[model samples]
Target: MTDENGWDMSASAWVIAQGENGDFTRQFVLDPVIDAWLAGRSFASALDVGCGEGRFCRRLKARHGIVAVTGIDPTEPLLATARAKDPAGDYRLASAENLPFEDHRFDLTVSYLTLIDIPDIERAIAEMARVTAPGGTLLIANLNPFITASGGTAWVKDDSGAKRFVKVDRYLQEHSDWQAWRGIRILNHHRPLSRYMTLLLAAGLRLTRFDEPPAIGGPTEARAAYNRVPYAHVMEWTKA
Candidate 1:
């Protein structure tokens, strides 16, 4: 279900479903890509915007050698879970649209799979860019516009109950949709790829790397099919 602020209040379900690594897509596809991509970069401080359970924030300290990592989310339940897990962790209740920080406050700022949940994406992107230090990186992982164009992850099936293909409609139109999985109910917004790129460019950030990672090891047929279609886009941008 949703909260007063329109955020999904399914923190427990999300943590249980994702565990430490994340859901299937994040565990197999997104994490590997992000880890490898981050291996070549260096940052002493990091901020995870919309960090649900602060998993990435903890990982940034343990795996990526970032001594200081801060996580922020609007959902109280999620922040509670994050704090319970790491009492010493810096997990704050905040919105991506208005980060509580000064200009260029972080060496690395990240938005991991949370942009779709944000209604004011342009403002959030600007905030992310604002918090990132000059020459530092603003890494973002988001649902691919093409995939969200289908409205949801629902795919059309064939006569034998076999998945045919992902259906996409009104791709060029920007709108919001509802998604329910397990006990989680959330709102997701869809916009064309150009909209995101233009906003980032307008914010004075340069796109350095971009990739559309595919499902690696999931249900065989689904994996194969998803490989052909981009599911998510991971990008690394530097503030100029």
Candidate 2:
């Protein structure tokens, strides 16, 4: 099945996996960095591109006091769940490649761990830049390119079943791989880090901050494992 279909099929499981606190990476790694960057800043409106289940949208409002938060995703089942959870929230059925909104409409735009799911990343990044108001921020959290390039077989474990190192190949190649775990199956696209950097820079966005954050808190073992090979990075950009 197509990745889109897979998301539709696994919507329930996905929602369950991301309970109230979110998964380990989100709870410990991404959220802290996001919150720190957003601290003391207020925006009237925000857009969460590929916002599954409206998690970050709610976070923006509840934590940051953002008044108008909109979330868009291609998966209807996910949108349905989002709307069900936040009945008054503006959750739209849309894809990142073609956002259903006016140009420069949002004060702050976000793409949290969703870039890998986008097939036409160039168009999607352009669309994201187009909809972001001048001076508005485009914050993104994504899996590290090395982790994606590893194709889910990143760890090389020793005889004692301890990870020795990460195995990565074809780092310059762009491809897709099927990933299945915890009752969810999906296809994620992999691109060289240079590809993402070049595209974002060409989109007329200026990079304000970049980070490969380590886990701040979680299970001792899990956090230590993640810190050994940090799998995610965050980039904050602004449209000029």
Residue-level lDDT tens digits of model 1 in 1-240: 448434556667888887887777887778889999889567988999998888888888888888889999999888988999889999998999999999999989999999898889999999999999999999999988887877886588889988777888889999988887877777789999899999999999999999988777867876787687768889999898
Task: List TM-score per model, in order.
Answer: 0.94, 0.97
Q: Which structure among the candidates has the greatest TM-score?
A: 2
Model 1 / residue 200 / CA error / Å: 0.1
After superposition, candidate 2 runs with Cα above 4 Å error:
1-5
CA lDDT of each prediction against the hidden true structure: 0.87, 0.94
Question: What is the lDDT, from 0 to 100, of the residue 83 in candidate 1?
Answer: 95
lDDT of 2 by residue, 1-240 (tens): 345547888888999999987999999999999999999998989999999998988899899999899999999889998999889899998999999999999989999999999999999999999999999999999999999998889999999999899999989999999888899888899999899999999999999999999999999999999999999999999999
Candidate 2: residue pairs that collide: none
At residue 45, what lDDT does model 1 achieve?
A: 88
Tell me the lDDT of model 1 at 140. Answer: 93
How much lDDT does candidate 2 score?
A: 0.94
